[model samples]
Target: MASFLALLPRSLTTFLYAVAALLRFYGNIDTTPISKIPLTILQWSFITFILGTAALLANLGLEWNAGNRSRNREIEERNRADQERQRAVSRARIQNRFFLLQTRHQLTPSPETRTALADFLSFLQEYGE
Candidate 1:
């Protein structure tokens, strides 16, 4: 069986492996003429090698998938943190503008500055909410 699989194209190897797996599960190799119930140590080793190769590839694929998922999650977390920082900085800028306008109005006592302060206070109230 191994020799037959080796003779086949590499592209067909995966399909053959699938077929081999189905046969292993349901075909009952013990009943087949090719299979001996009391398998020799060499025969057992060959079977183990065949199945182990498939298992190793499956394990590697699962690990690779897990790595990608973790990396993507980390990137998303970093992006969220950056956006939060940007929002905090924006709020600080708004607060600074409000304070500066209020101080200017207090010192000058002018109509324009008073109106500007009023408008900024309203903006601050709306944005802070």
Candidate 2:
């Protein structure tokens, strides 16, 4: 099937050429031709090639721009996810600190306990600094 399909165009081309030759022979066509026709056809072919190249370049440019936009969107999404994770971590740390302070206050509930809590907080602050 592939071979037959491949031969089809060659057969068609030969048949058309034979038909054109026969017609031209029978019609007794003049040998004279316009000189500008070939040049015009050549110029038109060149223009067509240029237009095709321009269209291909434009398509490539559009594809490249679309790829860049997709990449940028992915980067932005990753950055957003990272920022959300950082915020979650910060919130967890703050909650942990709050719970720890509450527990310490509950464990020690007298004037001496207050002084102890102040001293502990100061120690923590100094250590942190």
Candidate 3:
């Protein structure tokens, strides 16, 4: 959007120059009377060109903003989905560990395994929340 806005002035200038060249061409013709043609036509053409260019620039800005918003929405959705997956995996591991502990009727886990599971659960909570 910024880039297009930057180019807008240049584009308008070029369009005005082209219009002037066309008018000059018509003016050069040996028609009945060049002076009689309303100068309003040239003035109106320049005004119309400027208005049209402004509209075009506004449209480009709107589209660019919408596209960026859509991309951000997509990224947010992807992150949410990833977090959900991680939570599901962590829940499953915790349940499995609990089940094994129940079957063995033991409250104690091997130190290394306990530390690893605790760390994994902490990571899941940090990201999934």
Order of models, best TM-score first: 2, 3, 1
lDDT of 1 at 94: 100
Q: Report how far off residue 54 is in candidate 3 (Å).
A: 0.3
Which lDDT tens digits does candidate 1 get at residues 2-103? Answer: 655433444344554665565556544343334557664344445655865666566567668769999999999999999999999999999999999978
> How would you encode candidate 2's per-residue C-alpha lDDT over 52-125 as one tens digit per residue?
55555655666687699999999999999999999999999999999999888768779877888799999999
Model 2 TM-score, 2 decimals? 0.55
lDDT agreement of model 2 with the native: 0.66
RMSD of each: 11.4, 13.8, 13.0
Looking at candidate 2, the ten consecutive residues that score lowest on lDDT are 38-47
Candidate with best lDDT: 3
Please give the CA lDDT of all the candidate structures.
0.68, 0.66, 0.71
Return the top candidate by TM-score: 2
Residue ranges of candidate 1 with Cα displaced over 4 Å: 1-44, 110-129
Q: How many steric overlaps are in each model, in order? A: 0, 0, 0
lDDT of the structure predicted as candidate 1: 0.68
List pairs with backbone clashes in candidate 2: none
Off by over 4 Å in 3: 1-39, 106-129
